[model samples]
Target: MEIYQAFLVALVACFGKFTGDIGYFMFDRPIVLVPLTGLMLGDLQQGLLLGAELELVFLGIVSIGGATPADVNMGSVLASAFAISMGAGTDVALALAFPIGVLLQMVKMLIYFFRATTMHKVEEYAEKAEFDKITFMHFGHCAIYVSVYGIIAFCSLVFGADAIRSIVEAIPQVVMDGLQATSNMLPAVGFALLLNMLWDKKLAILLLFGFVLSSYLQLPVLAVSIIALTIGLIMIAQDRSSSKTAVQTTGEINEEEDFFNA
Candidate 1:
C-alpha cells in the first residue's frame, strides 16, 4: 500500500477510536468506518459491502458502563484496509473480523485500566480547582488514544498487508469455507446475546408473531414493523387508561364510605 493510503487509514482509525464516546460523529460505526476506509483506498463499494456484513456481526456488541465488548470498529478499519490492499473479497474480510476485534479489544481494555488510574490525579486537580490542568489531561488522554491506534493503523499498512494476504492464502480451502460459515453465524450469536441481556418472554412471543406473519402470511417487514409499533402504542395507552380508571374508582369508593360515615 502507498504511504499516503496508510496515513489516511490511520487518520480514520484515530477518528474512529474515540468517536464512539467523544466525537459522537457515528464514524466509529462499521457502516461509516468501512466506507471511509474504502473511500480512502479508492474502493468505496468494497468498504460498504464489508461494512454491512460486519455491522450485522457486531450488531449487539455495544459498550456500556465503560465496558469494552470488542473493538469491532478497529476490526472494521483493519479488515477493510487489509481486504482492499490485498483484493481479498468481503467473505475473507468477514472471516478476519472477529479475531481482529478481539485483539483490539485487549488494547482498549488496557487503556481503560490505565486511564482509571488517573482518577486520583483528576481528584487532586479538582481539589485544587485547577480546571485548566483537567482540560489539559483530557486532551492528553485523547492524544494518547489517537496516537496508539494511529501507530497500529500505520504499521499495519506499512508491514501487515502482505502478511494478512499470505495468511488468507495459506489457510486450507475447507478452513476458509469454515471461516465463512462461522462469519455468517456471528449475527445469530449477536442476536442471542441481545436476547440474553434484554429478553422478555412476552417480547419473544411478539418476535415469534412477527416471524410467523412474515414467513406464513408473507407480510413485508416494514408493514409488520408498523403493526408492532401501533400495538406497542395501544398497549401504552391502555395501561394509562386502566391506571386512571382504577384511581377514579378508588376515589368514588372512599367518597361513598365518607357519605355513609357522615
Candidate 2:
C-alpha cells in the first residue's frame, strides 16, 4: 500500500507541472518532497527530520545550464521511504541517502542526453516559423523527460527500497562504518559545489567573515545567513550610491561643457 502511495506521489511530483525536467533542484527540494513522501508512508515527522538533514547536505546542489549535478529527488524519496519502513532515524537515513544521491546524478545525466535528441525537432520547428509547433515540440519533450523520471521513481518505490534494506541489513559492521565515513564526506562535496558557484576574489572577505562568525563565535547557521544578507544589502546600497554620484558628476561635467561652448 505504501508502495502504491509512493507511485502516486512520484507521478504527481513529476507530472503535475506538465513537465518532468522542471529543473532538478526546484521539484527535488527535500524539504518539500521528502515530507510528501513521508505522508505517503504514514510517517510525516520522520520524513521531515530526514528531509531537513538531506536539505543541509544537498543545499548547494544545483543544475547549471545542461548539467544535472545530483538527483536529490530520488535520494530523498528513497532514503525517507526506506528509513520510515525500517524505523530508522534521520541521521541513519541521511547516511544511506548521500551515496544514493551521487548515483542518481548519473541517471540524470543520461536523461539529459535523451532530452537533447528532441532539440533537433525543436530547431526544425523554429526554422519553419511554426511557433505553435515549436511550443508543442518543447512541451512534448518536457512530457517525455517527466515520464522517464516518473517511471524510474515508480520502479524504485515498487522494487528498490526493499532490496536495498535487505542488502543494508546484511552489511558487516565495518562496511556500515565505511558508509558513515563516506556520508561524512558528502558535505564537503556540497560545499565544493557551492564554492564553484560562489567563489569570487571580491567575495573572499565575506566568506572569511562567515567562517569566523560560525567557527569562532559559534553562531547558528540562521544567524550567519542573516548577517551575510545584511552585509550583502550594505554592499548593494554602497554600489547604488556610488553609481548615483557618478551619474550626477557626469551630468555636471556635461553642463560645464555646454556653458563653455555657449
Candidate 3:
C-alpha cells in the first residue's frame, strides 16, 4: 500500500487502543477492529480470521487493579496489518502480535506513569471549582493519549510493515518453529488466566456446569448463556418468594398475639 494509505489505516487502528476507552466506538475490540484493518489492507477475510484468533489469545487479559497483561489494541492493529501486508500465515501473525502487545503495554504504562503528574493540575482546578479548566486538562490528556498510541501506530503501519516482512522472511527455521509453537500455547494460557480470575469455591459448580455444557454436550455458547441467565432469574425469583413467605408468616404471628392480648 502507499504511504498515505498506510498512515490512514494506522490512524484508524489506533482507536482500537488509544481512544478505545473514550466512547461508544469500541474500536479496541479485536473482533471489530482487526477486520477493519484487514479491509483497509484489502484482505478482510484474513483479517477477520486473525482477529478471532487474537481475541481468544487475549480473552483472559483484563485490567484488574489498573493493569493489563498487554496492549490489546495496538497488538491487534499492527499484527493484522503486518501479517496481511506480508502475506504471513495466521500462526506467524499470532507470534508477532504477542510481542508487540507486550511492548505496547509497556509503552502505555510508561505514558500513564508520567500522565499521573497531571492529577495535581486537576486537583488545583478542583480547589477553585474551575470545572472548565479541569475539562480542558482532560482533553489535553486525551491528546497525549492520541499522540502516543495513534502516532506510534501510524508510523508502524506506514513505514514498518515492509521492514518487518523482510525480517520475518529472514528468520531461521528453528526460531520460526518456536514462534509458531508459542502461538499455539497462547490460547491455553489465556483460558487458564481467565479461570484463575473467576474461580471461587462457592461458584465451582457453575464452572463445572459450563464445562459440561461446552465439552460434553457441545452446546453453542449462546445456548449456554441463555441457560445460565434462566437459572439466575429463577434463583432470584425463588429468593423473592421465600422473603415474601417469611414476611407473611411474621404478620400472621403478630395477629395471633394481638388476639390473645385482647
> Residues 1-262, candidate 2, lDDT per residue (tens digit)?
3667767767655743342254434655777777777787787887787777777678787667777665665777777777787887665577667677787677666866887877888788889899998877667777766776678777776777778778778878786677667666766787877888878999898888899999999999999999989988999999999999999999999999999999
Q: How close to the true structure is residue 217 of candidate 1, measured as C-alpha lDDT?
A: 96
Error of 2 at 228 (Å): 2.6
Report how far residue 239 has shifted in candidate 1, in Å: 7.8
Better of 2 and 3 by TM-score: 3
TM-score of candidate 3 relative to the true fold: 0.77
The per-model lDDT (C-alpha) reads 0.85, 0.74, 0.80
Residue 83, candidate 3: alpha-carbon lDDT: 85
lDDT of 3: 0.80
User: What shift in Å separates residue 10 of candidate 2 from its native position after superposition?
Assistant: 1.0
- Comparing candidate 1 with candidate 3, which one achieves the higher lDDT? 1
Name the 10 consecutive residues with the lowest summed lDDT in model 1: 18-27
Runs in model 1 with CA error above 4 Å?
23-27, 64-68, 213-262
- Cα lDDT tens digits, model 1, 1-262, are 9999999999899888767646677679898898899999999988888887787777788878867676788988898789888887766877677788899888877886888899799999999999999989888887888789899889988998888888889989998778778878887886787778888876888889988999999999799989999989998999999999999999999999999999
How many residue pairs clash in model 1?
Answer: 0
Residue by residue across 111-133, what tens digits does model 3's lDDT show?
78888977998898999999999
